[model samples]
Target: MAPIRTFIAAPSNLGLKPPAPGVAPGVRHLPEHLQQFSFASRAGAVQTIYLEPPTYHGDIDPETRMRNADAIRGYSIVLAEQVQDTVRAGRQAIVLGGDCSILLGCMLGLRSQGNYGLFFLDGHTDYMWPEHSATGGVAGMDLALVTGNGHEKLTDIHHCRPYVPEQQVFCCGNRVPDESYVQLIRQSQINYYDLDALRRFGLPATAVQFLQLVETRGLDGFWVHLDVDVLHNDLMPCVDSPQPGGLSYAELRSVLLPLLSAPACKGIDITILDPTLDPDGRYASVFVDHLTGILQDAATAVL
Candidate 1:
């Protein structure tokens, strides 16, 4: 049977660049917005824990060369501790994020337990070095940081560099192209499948392939990183950076359901849903519906 689901809300926008000077990104409210729609109840969450994030700062930290780097680093450690505690108790964590950077904390926590694989589903690869990043926001460079591509500060947390091995990761659903970071990810050992690749190989098949890899490698488990922008911009336009093409609700369900059904799947983090863009809550409501439905369906299938 699937383990009990525990929702951890780490609503810190320190990973993202502010829209303007001294203005915090509205993405920080992601957890609260989803909870307003009763996401935890609908997803059958047994417990809900909210981590208090550090204050957001707009200035770039000289040491890390990333905006709000200091705050983000501290928050990631705190977030990691909570994730470790949740997993140690034998619960499946469904982390509600402030941005993609929270992936660091999730992975760091998993690294402490043992080696784990990653299913990184996003519209952009998010694998850029600090020098290549235009905004210097850790959100854009999360995948890189987690893979030990950046400075020691963020990557060497707990003296564990490369939280999850590059070879153990499966980066899927990236639609953006013709970028330096895209090239970077392609050169890495991570199994990369772009939007076209997903269509060519088939979504469900691709997920199964990752699962087989995890089993054969004898990983402790795997984590799922679901950035909401992976959904078609028409369907999920409330994200920070929306592009032309992405997955639809049904398409996402087809892929995510299989990953979530696996006993080896440790946790999944949902990120980048900006509530400010959906004032009437139409998009957020549908998002909640589809997500909760997928989680429920996965549980049933495993049973």
Candidate 2:
């Protein structure tokens, strides 16, 4: 494998607001530290691309959600095109996101060439359909869309359904999954390691288990979607939905280290950082610090 090509696909339309007045100015940019891990910036082994988010307000109506979803899908299409072009040219892609929904486009882009496994780390299942959704927020429908279950436009992005078989998908760090969604997961063959399970199994061991499953399933490749809310809210409160009793910062690193080290892992999407929610920017800084370490380690391993 060649050096990793990092792309920060900032699709800010997920409707999270920036910090309110009187909040520190530096809070919003805390995650910028991630750029320091770029191989291009330091050792020149990692290439970085920062994508600007599309303009869309986060609203809760079906019409508004659909419209925003379309915009997000469109933006992802463009991003996927770039990702495909880069991978075709022989480079790995790492996408930093505006929200978890960006995974739809990132997956679409990767699957265009061949099948890829998915590792979804989030507080919620994000598998709720519009009808099942309590908030009717498109962000919650992200996983459902990618799995070919929601709005037609989202599922049909890139001219084909991008549902990697349920067996090929792994949902981790889910503390607040909907009951119906849990049933949906149980009915399907998808692998799920919720918060309690993660605590019992530990991140490295759990990650290894998933990797073994991927190998046994003969997956072509794998992508990781890490939502900051998967971390303990106290440590990473700058997300759209903050949950308690989540993974600790160290635990998160443990989970990601092995995945990042895996030869089959293709790309990553780090999402759900709401700067406005962080009063002191400490949360963003902490999350980014750990993320930067992972990127740096990945770049070193690949190099």
Q: Going through the candidates in order, what is the number of backbone clashes in each?
A: 0, 3
TM-scores for all candidates: the values are: 0.98, 0.85
lDDT per residue, candidate 2, 79-195, as tens digits?
777766766766666666666667777778777868778889888777767777655555677777777777676787756785566668888888875566677666656688778
lDDT of 1 by residue, 1-303 (tens): 756989999988888888877679998889989888999988879999999888887778888888877777788898888888888888899999889889999999999988999999999999897899889899999999999999888999989998999999999999887865588898999999999999899999999999999999999899999999999999999998989989999999999999998888889999999888888889999999999999998877842
Error of 1 at 272 (Å): 0.5
Question: lDDT score of model 1?
Answer: 0.90
Q: What's the lDDT for all of these models?
A: 0.90, 0.67
Largest TM-score belongs to which candidate? Answer: 1
Off by over 4 Å in 1: none
